[model samples]
Target: KREFITDDDSSDVTGAHVSKIESTIMVKTEASSVVLTQQQTSHLNHSQQSITTQQQQQQNVHIKQQPQQHNNIVQQAHPQQ
Candidate 1:
């Protein structure tokens, strides 16, 4: 099993503003599990149009899987809170 979390924050003076966001990701398999986490922050001044700031952080876990002897395989992406 694996677990992940992500947070996003954004602000704009004249446009849409996203105050905060949170997300989590997880992956599990018969052989291994993986997890990922990410965070991002951004600020924009629409009046100036030239001033902008952004920050991002990410964390990931990697699991090595053995070569599959069978040809049957599947992949999927699912959102989980």
Candidate 2:
């Protein structure tokens, strides 16, 4: 038997319409903010770019608290797991 499979999952948003977010963060003693912009690279394709950026932010944020009962429920939501 000969069979093949194709996984097709993409958005209706066109390449010309969709905006890519490439942010630069400024870490200071007082506060921190990111400058959001659309950036393009030569080597990486859209699929690779999308996969990398999807999980990028979750790696940077970790909340340390007293206990589960006293902790903020809103902040406890896991995006990666």
Candidate 3:
């Protein structure tokens, strides 16, 4: 009966070790997924910033052209060129 008790104790210890290994693996997988989400969010933010910059550049070009158009109109009216 003593030997049977010893065997049961060893089995319980082995079962606990297996569960610990499983939990560690689960934690590692969760951490990697979190990292992936962070990377995706940053990438999306970069794309949005680039889109806004492009829009600002376009607005600047339009503003620059308006003055040129006014100069052309003035020259046509005065025949100074």
Best by TM-score: 3
**Model 3 per-residue lDDT at 7:** 100
The lDDT of each candidate is 0.19, 0.30, 0.53
TM-score of 2: 0.18
lDDT for 68 in candidate 1 is: 28
TM-scores of all models? Answer: 0.12, 0.18, 0.45
Ranking by TM-score: 3, 2, 1
Candidate numbers, best lDDT first, in rank order: 3, 2, 1
Off by over 4 Å in 1: 1-11, 14-16, 19-59, 64-81
Q: Write the per-residue lDDT of candidate 2 for residues 1-81, one digit (tens) a residue.
A: 122222222343443234432122222211121112112321232334345543333322321223335334424554326
Q: Mind giving the per-residue lDDT tens digits that candidate 1 earns over 1-68?
A: 12222222222422232222211121122111211211121112222222321111111121123122
Candidate 3 local lDDT, 1-81, one digit each (tens): 999999999999999999999986775454444334333443453445445544433333443455644644533643542
What are the RMSD figures for all models against the true structure? Answer: 19.5, 15.0, 21.9
